[model samples]
Target: MPLALVDCDSFYASCERLFRPDLRKKPIVVLSNNDGCVIARSKEAKAMGIKMGVPWFQIKKAYLANGGHVFSSNFALYGDMSARVMNILECMFLQAYEVYSIDEAFLDLDTLDKNFNLYKFGCHVKRCY
Candidate 1:
């Protein structure tokens, strides 16, 4: 089966960037419920030793010291964004595609006659996203 897996880098951060221009180049974190832990981190945040599920209290000092912005999970916004992404994909491809998560999807390319260009296809998916 020909398949394509599209994974967004720093998905939460990218989602935040979509709405807030100021966050585009900054260190950002998406926290879990009650702002208890870090569920997602931008590349910058990852480099600073802020691990996923690290208690918010333990990381608060370092996060502030490092100028990281913490945000509560905005599922509403993320969900809307995800729907748009899926709609784009549905319009672009003829074969069946399944959204695995907000940041991941699988596409079937079995019908394409030529050997599928996985990398190029991934690039297209990335751009669509």
Candidate 2:
């Protein structure tokens, strides 16, 4: 199987920004289940020394001081973004595929001829969403 796992660098933070206009340029963190801990942090947040999996209460002060936005996992928002991204993939490939997660998918592109440029294909995928 010519499968590829295309993981986004900071998927949760990116997904959060999809709907929250104000979060685009700021540091952001997504908490884990029950909003108990930090599961994801943006590059901006990481630069501030916010470690992943830190308890929310422990980081509350730092988060606020650093202008970090904290969001509980909003599966709905992530799901919608995932769908939008996958729909873009569906348009480019010719065969069966399965959405593995909100940010990943497996597509069978066996039918594409030798002329298909995989790098350009990936770039087009990146641009689509």
Candidate 3:
């Protein structure tokens, strides 16, 4: 059996948007501590050319000029959401797994039957979210 890894992109921004569905299609950026830098950016924000780790002040003009949304780093909210996702993965899919980060995990797939279809499993996982 092969192991699998699951990682969420723009994790901090994604968690922030979970409570603000209005921002789903809008560009959103989550800043680092003290509102210093761009730590996480949604796909829309990336499309707007907001590179990760750039100081917020440097891009303030461009970002605000384009009506982008900015958010402070919220580790508590992100951690809670990550825990919910991990619990769902463990209880519904993996027999054993290791959390690689707040937004990544390594799942043991040995317990799955040999005939399991990986593509179908991936689609199922996506639907779970």
Give lDDT per model, in order. 0.82, 0.81, 0.89
Q: List the candidate 1 regions with Cα displacement exceeding 4 Å.
A: 113-129
Q: Could you tell me every candidate's TM-score relative to the true structure?
A: 0.83, 0.77, 0.89
Error of 2 at 63 (Å): 1.8
- Candidate 2, residue 92: Cα displacement in angstroms equals 2.3
Residue-level lDDT tens digits of model 3 in 34-110:
99999999999999989989999999998999999999999999999999989977885665888999999988888
* Tens-digit lDDT string for candidate 1 (20-82): 788766889999889988899999898888898898899898788878888899988888878
Q: Rank the candidates by lDDT, best first.
A: 3, 1, 2
- lDDT of each residue in 18-71, candidate 2, tens digit only: 788777678999998899999988898998889998999998996798688988
The true-versus-predicted C-alpha distance at residue 68 of model 2, in Å, is: 1.3
lDDT of 2 at 99: 77
RMSD of each candidate relative to the true structure: 2.4, 2.5, 1.7
